[model samples]
Target: MTQLPLLEQAILVLAALTLLASFSMLAQSRLTSAIHSFAWQGVMVAAATALVAAVGHAHHLYLSALLTFSLKGLLIPWMLHRLVRRLNMEREVENIAHPALVVLAGALLVILAYWIALPIERLELASTRNIIAISLAIVLLGLWLMIARRQVVTQVLGFMSMENGLFLAAVASTRGMPLVVELGIAFDVLVAAVLFGVFFFHIHESIESLDTGKLTRLTEEEPA
Candidate 1:
């Protein structure tokens, strides 16, 4: 740690915090708190990307950092908050069959990610190599969150978190993609949030709840 430059150390701290935020989200029950954690993760990611730019001398990464901060950190979070308010689902608690087991699984995922990224880390010379495993762990955790939860909003949060992990991986490994590609991804996320909002309204109207498990009842056969 002492051998690395100060900027790299700072980025590592932010990256670690980002990973912690992912775990926090995985453990949180309230919808609003999960959204807050997701926003914090976005901020950490933006800060890390900006620091990466400083360390790597990639000025273009600055643009991506700004976009990520504005889109992921600010706009998307605000959108989710509004959706929660509109649906009156802000206080809804996620249903996890086994919280302790879920947390344990997430930890195991981190260990697995480290093992899988070991070869790639060996081949890479960037300071970000150390964090690649963490990024992959976050991605897997998000996927696991989606599968464990029954609520649509929670599933959406998982989806966004997975994308966050992908962005973090790109920034860490390559100092971010081209400005055009990042811009497209940012726009796509915004659009997806909008579409999710629409779906929420339709789902509520049809079933009076956002529980995806309720959808299964619609397919059951009726007596003749």
Candidate 2:
């Protein structure tokens, strides 16, 4: 087997960490552990970005690393923790299905993503192409988490995870996108989170729980 260079090795290690984080997200039933898993994923992403920047001598990637560490790694997860606490819904998270099944489904998604990304090799650097597979898999897993679960809160968390995967894909493929673009995405995600926060209260009041089945009541009317 050919020896991997330091940069490639670093990226691979980070990719593995990301995969683990996704699994952790899938496995976690409660809000606090899920938030922690997401934070760890952000940390790994920042470390990977820093290592890549050092190896490639791309100063912009260093800035990207710092931004990721602050926003996703710290701020957003912290906000999620506080939000859950304020809602008094910390230990009350309800998964629509068993966690073991969810995790198995996520594993299948990773395999599918690898197969799906195989043809995209024509578009990116060799290392980037492989990383893209892992990135897309994470995104898919996030989406699955959103769909498989009933709680709007968990769905929002899944959306955030999806954005994280998108960020990883951008960095892996392009060594980080333009600063303006990155900032735009960050702003958009922040706005989305706030919107979800508002929605959480609304959902709670209307349905008494954020569960999807309960949300169907929003469309039904009590006949007078």
Best by TM-score: 1
What is each predicted model's overall lDDT from 0 to 1?
0.89, 0.83
- Could you estimate the TM-score for every candidate? 0.94, 0.91
Q: State the lDDT of candidate 1 residue by residue for 1-224, as single tens digits.
A: 24888888898899899989989988998889999999999999999999999888999999999999998899999999998898888778867778999889989999998999999898866867888888998899899889888888888988998999899999998778898998999899999999999999999998888988888885545425
Off by over 4 Å in 2: 122-124, 218-224
RMSD of each: 2.4, 2.7
lDDT of 2 by residue, 1-224 (tens): 87878777978889889889988888887878888998898888888888878877889989889988998899888888888888888887675467778888899999999999888876657565688889999899889988888877677878888888888888877788888998888888888888888888888787767777765554566545
How does candidate 2 score on lDDT?
0.83
